[model samples]
Target chain A: MGHGPGYVEADEDMSNPLGLKAKLGLDVFKHDKEPHITIKAGMAGDQRLKKAIIVCPAGLYSENAQGEVELTIDGCLECGTCLLACGSEVLGWQYPNGGAGVQFRFG
Target chain B: MSQASTFDVIVVGAGLAGLAAAYTMAREGLEVLVLERGEYPGSKNVTGGRLYLNPIRDMFPDLWAKAPLERHIAHEEVCLLDTEGAVTVRYDGAELGTQPYQSYSILRAKFDKWLGKQAERQGAMIVTKSRVDEVLFENGAVVGMRAGGEELRTNVVIAADGVLSFIAEKAGLREPFKAHDFAVGLKEIIELPRETLEARFNLQGDEGVARLYMGDVTKGKFGGGFLYTNKESISLGIVAGIEALNEAPSTIAASQMLEEFKLRPEVARLIAGGETAEYSAHVIPEGGLHAFGKFFGSGILVAGDAAGFSMNIGVTVRGMEYALASGYLAAQAVIRAKQKEDYSAAALSEYERLLKESFVMKDFENFKDSLHALENPRLFTYYPRLAGDVMRDLYEIPAGPKARIFPTIRKYFSVGELWGMGRDMWRLMKI
Candidate 1:
């Protein structure tokens, strides 16, 4: 089926894959001075860390040029999908202190 | 250690469970303190935006009259989709539209904030922007917790934290996390004009629709997509098994899956002209009874997602009611313990007993195998595609003579496929 009559696009920008940055920008967030999550030292290349790339809803995990997994904590939904996909051994995860992380207005 | 910081009972997290516990206890003249990490009660809470009231209405007898519910769901639908086509089944029963409606669409931010106010009015003290940093123990029993560098003490502590509860784990009530036991959901609250939303969904005043899509929604993963009609917005989202998403031959980011799902013709038309108001994600505890660990410890109790209270059994997904019930029951157990001057594990075991005697545990026992049954990949992939292909052939009016309907449909159900279907049906019967 194709778009029927009277179909109005929600937003032109939505037609494109709303990248991680743009999707996260739609919600409210309070930035923390220090990232709440970090790849444990010397475990960046661990196989377990790779799963976060697929399961993190915000798409916060990615592989660098060296094929080592990297993570940016901004826009982290604090869903803990990464921590479950990758074990605690490869990632040090915690909710941003007290009131520092995301503040969802419509959750 | 000061008496000013101590309370009869302290509840962590201010979602449904925490609020319910505080409301129940505070109403009974027991001092109750609720701690929430977010800016407000629901700042970090998420749901598909529907709540079944039949199970919880009686539990909170007077609360529904003025609750800020969005709409009463009058339509139930399920859609099976393939790459090119889709099959949809809609159910509209007269009873669904009658008074004392079974369920209603809800927004957590609005609903939870109102519930917080109700709890506060009942004499419960709630402190927002406070996150529990440590679960303190004395003589191997939880006595209190530390939050925001302040040590708060209480006679009993209730861990009503959401899924991925650090409080539960730190108190030795839950085991290490397992990927197979959870699913991640991403949702967008797309706002539409009230008139447009009602007309588009064919809903009358205060009427709403709840639709679920399987198959291509999750790219054959073990999860599905859900849409709920709110008063002026649609809650559209996809839930995918973390393990399935991770172990698939080709990896696709969860965020990309949502974007694609919205583009599907069947979904796109429904949401046309809507403006996305917000985007949120949260992990759901879908592992059912098998994944449950200890829910109570000495001087402590676990409730809500923290205790794995959510369940999905194809047609209905429930959690909020379970959270409300469990929190209420936990409060009951604590009240009993306080009367006897006991906060030990043996006394708190009453919480589990109360659950087993209620619908909360009974429902879990009945459908404990649903998660395993839903894990079959063919249910999400092969079946939807087969149904779509069969439908396409049956509906096509070609240039040549049309084939007989029975034969055209029968051709695809080979003996092997029939046997496989039988096996899958047998497995499903267990739930």
Candidate 2:
């Protein structure tokens, strides 16, 4: 049988948003720290940030009840969609620490 | 010497382009350091499985014997999906998969790490998981980069930093990727029994196949789906235009789109009873030359996806080969510059000369018009329906008299529509 690190034994069922993170196999930071990507808190009312809430492919960006930016960095795919959605003024974009973000098991 | 002055070349991103450039430079006796953002080289990368060997073979002959390649692709399949049916055209040839094979399916996590190791074997320092935060410049020349709060200096900075290329942006080489120029690809690696996968794809040991789907697969958007056979799994995915998706007359989430695609009888047949091993999403540049920016600046050169080196010509979506080629050329230019001890834009212009002479520029410039033709709505929506209607007409027997072939074909695609398709074909395939 052809077997190696890239191959994984799979289970039936569509991977949901929560289950998707596990499949990504990202190595998490040991300590609670600031995320590499942050939505501009002061610019929460900015229209671009508002639109980024829906445009982000990972669905990691959202809006609070007050229609402000709410972003979750845990499952960020690092595709840079949010950066493109909201430029430097409203988004802080950087690669996650050496080895602590979205790691694709089969990319 | 200080830590910043240790290396001659410091490459950000340990993907294929970075590795290829490092390997070439290191082999030529230059001090090289490669910084990777992922836990490993390939962990942050993805592909549709076909890595054209021509460029790699040109760079490193006999690489296939040791590379972590899955299978040699010998069969090329094209399927067009419609509202209710599909039409497939298959090509099987004996001359394929011979020595110096054309292409193969590969898992990037293994193959890229292998490429990284190859470069490491040649004395390249590959620092995995270290993401370069910024490219430091001096007097309009790139001097080095800072990563993880540490600064490292080098004579040249090669930006093989994938599609987004924050490093390239730091050098002022690229603008923020716009949705119109980008396409988001979502894939599922579905594991299956080796024998089952072989049988399902109609292949013997080691032989593989690839299929590209047009039409309803993207829900009528300006993009397509692909299935590439790996050893124990199938790399199945869809690439849809992000801007098109954003403005789609009707739309659903990319996750929903993939789930719906998996339900299609045409797709469901291939992966029946299989399980999804992993799920992934990435964004690729599909705007041809329009997506490209300045590939070079003083003391810096951009390669791979970061340099906008990918091309999607309908029949094939190619990036890795272009990445390898650009990386190799960048190294050649770097080697030449090192001899002269000048890393200015004038010295780096040799890299552009090499690319212009190679398949990198020739192919993209040759196929530039297809980038426009691919956006034609008919190819994705109306034409696939036409194909389905034509297939249905040809297969189903009517109780009455049979119609002539020309009239039957014309009925599905009228004369004007045929002329329009002819123009699209002419524009896309003129090269």
Candidate 3:
């Protein structure tokens, strides 16, 4: 997913366990390798497994063993700068249902 | 039992308030239908985009276990700023880290969609892309709602259709909201690396911080800006009063003001190297407690922004909590009215009374002046510039003989034209 400047390619070398770093503001290439932290809950899917976790590194999108995971996130502070700059469709977005989602606890 | 109707109850708007009301009624065995004008719930909703947990505690006690929470807010910083600097007051607590968290950061698309699904699971029929054209009335009493050229009957009507609800207006529950009574807000959700977010704001784990800015960010206009930390993204935006904005010397639209706001050195540094994820705009009812119009009519009830219940007190922007609380209370009233087999205005007036009894109305009532003070222009304009100038002179390390800070402040205060600073401060004090 890191195709822009300073993007260190994700190595296909199976023998090398090290994950390559992506460009600034882009990281989900080998995010799955960031350790399988158990979530215990918070996912929607086959729930037979008593424990599950998906690691999404902090750049808005997180990748897991199941590939890019899509989750509904709310309570976002309304800042239009990032959306004005995002050039992807992976993020399905809108304000929290009116009267739902993030309240500027202190604004 | 061949009742000729699409559902027993028809809810217009798929927002949280609407969904909550529909869900509550449906869970109790009523055949409820939710009609949304957007492609989906939250699609047309806009908030500072933060969801407080107080209102949802009863409905989804284990929400953190299932709902998508961007970040659990552990610290909140409310900053008063000038062109060059800021003074921030922070309220940090370890209590916020646990269950029943004070608040969480969220993206509405995900939150509202999930909420709609939850409502659907409770047996309410949620229909999207259906605009409610009018409220169906019989003998001056609301009997149902009309949407997309289709009329649907119900025992009650919920107008949770957001700030400019036509249904409420059409029902004579509210008038067309004046520009001064409302605010135009523009926001952007920017994505950043988890490590970067944590490092920049000194956050640990999933803990997040919310920041509010007043003063120069709005070009001394009667509005403020906010920056909140999410899981891997930051929500940044500006909300300004439309009347004050229109009265400004410059033609900076809400969108343009947001652009300028983000470019400020303080905000720009935080979002530096971050990727813009989404851009959205919406209006907020900052009319405070005095703006709440008639909340209910014959067989109808209104909650959330539709009723002009948002409060814009300094350091706080509360609507969601009010919306959810009011929604729940409205549902309770509706259930009682249903049991009594009466949907008249008298039967439904319970919603208004109960809402007034709840903290929703109390808080709005207490801080009515805060909303007025925010619109006074001094907090956004003169103070920021004067304060910034003061800070620059006091903090700057000069090469020659040091000028005493007190005298500098006195001289500075004497030098600049305060332009109603005294009156603004006096009124703000009362606020």
Candidate 4:
């Protein structure tokens, strides 16, 4: 009975921290066709973008082998953490259009 | 049926603040419209899972009895965690368990949806899945807003939007965002059986516990972790300052902090057999009154996180009560302006005046220096380790001989450490 909608069983991986994708799977999201956030062109290699890799609670930001930061918006929590971490010059950020993005059922 | 293009009031974002303002004004016979950018009122909301009601109870006098509150908090705990050991202090006061309880554990998704219903019952028209894209201005005054590609007119607009308040920015009421002024929080709602939760938390019927963890929980960051016992689940999460996470000597994902916190021996055993029901993250305005910008503008007012109402004073963290109270006061100011048939900046300044005279402004003014005082790195690192070490040495029995109690405790407090402690204490006096 404790299992409600969107509940995901905790994985048994103890050696590694809970994977971001699995944790995001526990939330309800209404997908949007267009990405709501993007790393600004030419600014992907900006040092400011490095903060996004560390401060994004969803771990949506990562540095590629090219030393450029990349972002995936599928699991964006709409928390605005990355925006706050990386200034507007390096990231194009906005909330997903109305009714899209992660929806918290037990927030 | 054609909906009116104009409303007496348009409150953006259906969190606590917007709902409170809508409910207050609708009950006064005003045509209030609340625009929400989510599937439902609380669908985009998140909290640390507790609301302090004593400060806001009188503002919404009749709503508490039937509110969707999870449990009345009867116990308060603080856990200081080092890399290895921990020190915890629990307070179970008789007054805390009595009627007229001070606070309750809350789940915003449930409470906000219920609040929207209450506001509707009071004649407020709520439009869900409607995002306000722009603030409409006439002669440099806010006249309405554009949402869902439709221009909606209103005499005044209330920006009750959450922390990252774009509406307030669009209306020219806030300064540019600063990383140091905000913190990000990540929470997981872990579900368990009611009996198991009750037994684990030592709770009676409808009783709950609220615990805060510091030090290693955030990896010595400027924030901490929190756990609140719900009726049949637990809300566990971490709040780390964005600046702290960014400026750390090494890179660490904020989510990893929560993962490690859940594995701490002191926390792992409590929820050994629970399932995670939901995961959420939110940005909190932690800069205190110093970060507050122009809250009232020409025919526009800001409330809740949009106005930077949240604060962290080491022992307690609060925002919801301020949100609810500020929303109520904003409505009162609008009602007063309606009587004069004016929505000018001069007229709407009453909102700021009312806030200054209320507990909301008084509390902010009283603790305006809290955030700065808490920025000292020692509070998050040295102190916790010192506490854990002292406790360990005091309780541990040596192999052959036990050291004298005074020396065992006194050895850690060298002259330099004592001086640092004194300086920290003097800084905290501002709060």
Who wins the TM-score comparison?
Answer: 4
Give lDDT tens digits, candidate 2, residues B1-431. Answer: 23757899998888889999999999999999999978889988888768988766868864568899988999999999998999999988776757667889999988998999899999999998787877888999999988888888889999999988888888998876776777778788889999999888889889999999999888888889999999999999888777676555665666556767877889998999777776677778777776788888999999999998888888899999999889999999999999999999999999999999998998888887666778878788988998888888888778998888788777657788778878978866753
For B1-431, candidate 3 gives per-residue lDDT tens digits of 22356566677888878988887887888888888866667766666757888755775553457987788889889777776777677888778777768788887777888888888888999987676766778899888865656667878888998876768878998754555677667666778999999999999899899999998777777779988888888999887765565454654444446656776778888998886655555667888766777899998899887888788777778788777777778888888988898989999999989987888877877787887776666677666677677778878888998888898888655534554666677787856
Full candidate order by TM-score, most accurate first: 4, 1, 2, 3
DockQ-wise, the better of 1 and 3 is 1
lDDT of 4 by residue, B1-431 (tens): 22454688999999999999999999998889999999999999999979999989998898999999999999999999899988999999998999899999999999999999999999999999888888889899998888889888889999999998999999999899999999999999989999999988889999999999989888777999999999989999999999999775655788877887888878889878987878799999999888999989998999999999999998799999999999999999999888898999999999999999999999999999999999888888898999988988888898989989998898888898899999999998887
Question: For each candidate, what's the DockQ?
Answer: 0.47, 0.39, 0.02, 0.69
lDDT tens digits by residue: candidate 1, B1-431: 34453589999999999999998898888889999999999988999879999988887897999999999999999999898889999999999999999999999999999999999999999999898999988999998888988888888999999999999999998889888999988999989999999999999999999999999988888899999999999999999898999776557788888888998999999999787778899999999899998989999999999999999898788899999999999999998998998999999999999999999999999999999998888989898899899889989999999989998888788898899999999988977
DockQ result, candidate 2? 0.39
DockQ: which is higher, 3 or 4? 4
Off by over 4 Å in 3: A1-107, B1-3, B59-64, B412-425
The DockQ of predicted model 1 stands at: 0.47
Clashes of 1: 0
Candidate 2 displacement at residue B114 in angstroms: 0.9
Ranked by lDDT, top first: 4, 1, 2, 3
Please tell me what DockQ candidate 3 reaches: 0.02
The list of candidate 4 runs beyond 4 A from truth reads A1-11, A14-18, B1-5
Show model 1 residue runs off by greater than 4 Å: A1-18, B1-5
